[model samples]
Target: MMLPSDFELHRPATVGEAVALRAELGEAAALYAGGTELLLAMKLGVLDYEHLIDLKRIAGLRGVTCAGGELRIGAAVTHRELETHPDVVRELPGLAALERAVANVRVRAAGTLAGNLAFAEPHADPPALLVALGARVVLVGGEGSRELALEDFLVGAYETELGEDELIEAIVVPVGAPGAVYRKFQVLERPAVGVAAVGNLVGGVFDGAPTVVVGAVDERPVRVGAEMLDGAALDDEGAFAALAEAAAEAVEPVDDLSGSEDYKRHLTGVLAKRAVQALGDV
Candidate 1:
């Protein structure tokens, strides 16, 4: 690809400074961290920012912590860190496993989970599992800070609820879903369909309806209604088939190089079933 146009780089020492720069520059500025996505977009001429406010220098924006029944992942934490972090591996191995498979080793080494969600890429893997795990994002801006569900933060493909003056601070995921599993189909650099299933299954039945989320096949991660899997049994093929069908019917995919609409829909079902079965295996 061609080199991106010249842009001023600002290294903010603190979150306040970063937010201030964002507010002052507005749309002319973009937050930078793990340029795996941002730099590529800039180089490809899809985005042209006059200024890039780097958040990496902000000490508050790094590391992972656990408190109040949630895992708080910092905005600056790279995918490689997450994939290898002891806390992540122990608390949410499914997520760690998913992170290990994102893109390739290079992308994972530099891509931030916050950036991945902030970019709002439809073909990503984190959002689906995060959503199924009931993840929320903390956003800081000139007005202060606010938290919202990951599902709500993402508006559509290449779209989000983020404001020009706002930057993500962290992604908060609830703890205790040990049975969660993520499955995807990828023949290209990105997945064609991604699915995540989370629940406590024991004795061939789930304690409650499992939370299922489908991504890549749609503009954003689509959550399959819990009601659809109510009273479903993992041991029964018919029940699994019904749950899979429900997931497939929930996504509205478009034709692309990844596959046709029907093909994506089929993959969604297949992946959804596999995800649930993976949960059973856990």
Candidate 2:
């Protein structure tokens, strides 16, 4: 990789300052969290900016905690931090496991969840799982803050609803959805297709209305309801096959180095079945 072209840098001590700077510089400025994604894209000549505003210096933009019955994760919180944090372990164990499965040790060490989501990488892991877990994103701009559902925040491949002057402040996930599972099919550590299934455990069995999301095969996660699984038919192999086919047909997989569109569609069914089975609602 080569160095990106010259650009100015600013370290903001507060999120307000970061938003203000972005507003002041307009499209020339980029609010940077970890730079793991931004810098790499710049090196690839896919993205460029004249100014970088570092969010790491902001005091309250890092950490994991619980309040008001939701797990509040700061935008600057790295994957490695979430992977091992005690609070994350107790509150969102499925997410912790997913974090462990991120690219590798070095990427986990440097990558932030907010950065991961904001980049809106079609092949990334967090968005599907977060969407299944009913997560919400907190975005801040000069106008103050607004919260939007994770699925709504994501618009399409490499695109999002994040305003030019807005920065992700935090991600909030609902508590007590213990039966959550993440499963993925990857080649060379990059996910080809991923599935996340989550639901409440009622009386030792998963609730009937589980949320199932398929990712990496499409621009964003595509959710399939448990109704498609058919509780009575879940016991039959043919029924499960039908369910898998339905999920595969639901996504718009693209051809890439990881696999062809057909291969991703096949993986989507296989992984979605495995993920939901892991959650035991099947």
Give the number of the best model, judged by lDDT.
Answer: 1
Cα deviation of 70, candidate 1, in Å:
0.9
| Candidate 2 wrong stretches, greater than 4 Å | 200-206, 230-234
Residue-wise lDDT of candidate 2 within 1-282, one digit each (tens)?
788999999998988888889899998878788788889999988889999999987878998889788999999999999999998888888999999999999899988999999999988999999999999999999888999999999999989999988999999999877588899988766788899988654444444656889988789989975665534333557656766887888998878789888888888888877887676542
Q: Lowest summed lDDT over 10 consecutive residues: which window, candidate 2?
A: 227-236
Return the number of clashes found in candidate 1. Answer: 0
Clashing pairs in 1: none
In the order shown, the candidates' Cα RMSDs to the true structure are 1.1, 1.9
TM-score (C-alpha, index-matched) for candidate 2: 0.94
Backbone Cα, N, C clashes tallied per candidate:
0, 0
The per-residue C-alpha lDDT of model 1 at residue 246 equals 86
lDDT of each: 0.90, 0.86
Query: What lDDT is reached at residue 254 by model 2?
Result: 76
Off by over 4 Å in 1: 226-231
TM-score of model number 1 = 0.97
Estimate, for each residue in 31-102, the C-alpha lDDT of model 1 and write its tens digit: 999999999999999999999999987999999998788899999999999999998998999999999999
